[model samples]
Target chain A: MKIAFTTKGREWQSEMEPRFGRTDYILIYDEDKDTLIIFDNCEAKSHEHGAGPTVAKILIENGVNVLITGNGPGGNAIEVLKKSSIEVYSGAIEMSVKEAYDKYKNKKLPRF
Target chain B: MKIAIASGKGGTGKTTLSVNLASLLAQKNSVFLVDLDVEEPNAKLFLAGELLSEEPKYKMIPKWSEESCTFCQKCVEVCNYHALLGIANEILVFPNLCHSCYACSELCPTQSLPMFAQKMGTARHYVMPDMELIEGELDLGEEQAVSLISQTKTYVDKLLLKDTIAIYDCPPGTSCPVIEAVKDVDFVILVTEPTPFGLNDLKLAVETMRVLKKPFGVVVNRYDAQDDRVFAYCESENIEILAKIPNDKALAVLYSKGALIYHSSKSVKCELEKISCFLKSLTCKERA
Candidate 1:
């Protein structure tokens, strides 16, 4: 399973970004292999409107089955993710991407 | 001649000038006042007239025919707005994101995508004795102000009299809708107040007009003689100060009541007449 975390920076040490759509970076963790991949999320950073669904599409294309972030996604983006059977969890705010992943593994984060 | 009254900041008296000027101009010539501020059209509040006609405006949006669709994602690829998405066995459509560019339908490989009209807003027609007023009112939650403004202008174009002078009360700011309202006009009256915020946005509006290569002049609304910053900037730019309406409490009272100041104040009427005459002179100069 691939889990995505909205982050402030590309590395696992960077703090988890509160925003889902306009986050600067997304850190994807492959639970099976215990590997990590970082996406810059440049389009979300520059989008003036509809950033939520656009970023959601990017996550979906990256085979992300779970999204962990500090804040919630927009209504339309939530709808799209729900339709795609992707689970969204909100928690782990002010913590690093690696820490958030640890909390997710512990099932401490709240699912939306 | 077509003239647009625009302001970079809201509450700067674009509608006040447009309604009064159109009323005054209608006394002598056929006039059409178009309120292009669809998001919050307030020109009708000031004008005393009977509603003649109201028609709903529609814009083309893509409708997918799933039976013929091959799930190739061509339509999704062509949509720049991300309004379309090919997910699994179905295509998802987000109407809010669609720009109605028809590119998706045009790019459909199997001709599976069709176009349909969606209600964007309403175009209203109001009639007074001397002038006709056409206003566009965008529906709540509609994000296609530019398209609706364009539709309103196109609707008025067909009904225009041979020598009718059209005045467009454009929306505030130098956005896409403002550009749609002011584009192709013979002249644009840029209204601004004497303040830092007003001047900053006025500079942006001026740059936009310059890029459009349209002839435009500045109107200093609520002008105070003590404020010299706006005057100094206008002088440095060599932009004509076509009119300066003094900040008066009586005018504010009339505006609050949805009444025209020119109708009750002789001095305001004179000032509006002078501005109208200046616009007429520009028309004559263009003809010559």
Candidate 2:
């Protein structure tokens, strides 16, 4: 299963963005392949509204099974994510993407 | 003529000016005071009127049809509002995010997404002595004020006739609802105060009026003789200061009691008269 984290930069050391919808990039971790995919989310960041649903769509399109981010998605996006059956975990706002990933692995992060 | 009273800042006396001006205007001519601030419409509270009719307002939202078979995700792709979600056998529709644009419904390949009228708000008509009041109030948690404002305007338009004046008590701020309120009006009256927050919002309201190319003026409410920032700003921008309803404790007391100040207060009446004179100069186009 692949997991996604909202982030500021493309690397593993990048700061985990506090904003889910307006995050600069969505870093996808393919656990099976041990590969990382960076999805630029600049358009969603500048969107006037519905950024959450837009990001949710991005997650679905990228086959993201888990969404690990800070301050999880809002109503509209969360509705779509929940309907799509993608598990959302938040509380990674204070850590880096790698740190957040490790926390997820260790079951330290909580489901949103 | 349709004269919209708007203020970028809240509590700048848009409702007070609206009710009083409509009252003052109704004495000589037919008047309609429409409170388009659907979220918190309170103009009816100040008027002693009988309820004529109350009607629910609806806006079209796309409804997903599962029986139509093709789950090609065309409805999801065309929805600009991101209100639609298509995954496997089901297509989720989030009505709150829907702008009722009809793009998704119209573009759906198998006609699975059809438009449905969903109740969003209500229009209550109240008949007073000389004037009438029509205000739209949105249901709690409703997302778009612009749609309801437009719906209210359309409802009001049907009730209006030639040579009568319609005063729109618009929502606060220089946002979509404010735009929808003032966009088609014959003139715009921007209510403001002398304080910094008032002036800052006044500038934004002024910019909004300018952008819409609407003939507009300013009405400084709760005016203090001490602060002249609003005056200075209006002069620099070449905007007419239509009236200045003084900062009076009596008016506040009356307003808090849900009483119409102009009916009992001389100072407020004087200011409303001044605003009336300016409004009389502008003419509304004859109905076809």
Candidate 3:
């Protein structure tokens, strides 16, 4: 299944990619892809609101099934993802985005 | 009459002003200090107090039972918040996106949707040395903060009916929650510092108050910041400069340790007295 990780823009591009173990792929607005491409959201800018949501929307439109995040599933971004019927894991601030995806896949994460 | 101290931006000393001013007024009258900064309520720290109690409440959402749902898109069509969606198998409900409007339930095809409460968070009331501080804390995963703040207002109004001298320390942003807290107050003290960010945010906050038709004045904290933009904006708008607290590192240190400035500074005591008198005059005008 294609997956995307929703993150604060600052965390996306940091050199310290905070050990995400479950999901290997990241979502980014690649110039070559011309739309949001699932490569690594780490290619996106830091602390921006539009960049992450834009990428998430692109990923969802491109058939990404699951999206992982650090905070609870509330906010404008969550609203967008809910419309697409993408399953979101709300509690994952400590673990990496990939780890959260694994936990959700393994049924370790509770559905909100 | 209750006077709320608020800033458009965070970390601008709104809490410090409210705590000291409330403490100063509590000496003569029964003062009730309400910390409406639900995001990070820190007003109780300045006063020697413990949380009296807390109760969890919810932001109501329309729940649809799949058995009765006939795949009619009436609920989806009526939902302006886009909270309800009709998938192929069933109708989906997004709780976070819901604005608690029961239109979906009302417009349900088979009347399957019912409005139910979801736990939002708790509102804690604390009694301090000279004041009662009330705070409403939203749960970590909750999206509705305005509802919790409204609950705080309801309880404060019902309980503190005789409290003629109440000080409300409102949230930082000039958003829905701040508007909810300031709506019924008699007076608002717009606390801001003399910085670019301060001035910009002050403009937005003042615009909001003006739109609400609430009578308000400006309090320039950190008056020694060498920025005159706030003063210029206030003067142009004819907003009264009620008081100016200079850049005092001692007051900052006291605040860092959750202490009221009036406890340590003699000048703050005098400044607060002037503010109390100013509020009294404003209240008298409203009464007259």
Candidate 2 structure quality by residue, lDDT tens digits, B199-275: 99999998888989998999999988888998999899899998889898988999899888898878888888988
Q: List the residue pairs that clash in candidate 2.
A: none
Q: Poorest 10 consecutive residues of model 3 chain A by lDDT?
A: A14-23
- Candidate order by decreasing lDDT: 1, 2, 3
Which window of ten consecutive residues has the lowest lDDT sum in model 3 chain B?
Answer: B81-90
Every model's TM-score:
0.91, 0.91, 0.75
Q: Which is the winner by TM-score between candidate 1 and candidate 3?
A: 1
Better of 1 and 2 by TM-score: 1
> What would the per-residue lDDT of candidate 3 be over residues B66-127, giving only the tens digit for each residue?
88878877987787666665544566676766778799998776899999988887788888
Candidate 2 runs further than 4 Å off: B284-288
- For all candidates in order, the CA lDDT equals 0.88, 0.88, 0.73
lDDT of 3 at B260: 75
* Candidate with maximal TM-score: 1
Residue A70 in candidate 3, Cα distance off native in Å: 16
Q: Is the docking of candidate 1 incorrect, acceptable, medium or high quality?
A: acceptable
* Cα error, candidate 2, residue A96 (Å): 2.5
Q: How would you encode candidate 1's per-residue C-alpha lDDT over B140-233 as one tens digit per residue?
A: 9998799999999999999987678999999999988999999879999999999987888889989999999988999988988777888889
Clashing pairs in 3: A10-A47, A22-A98
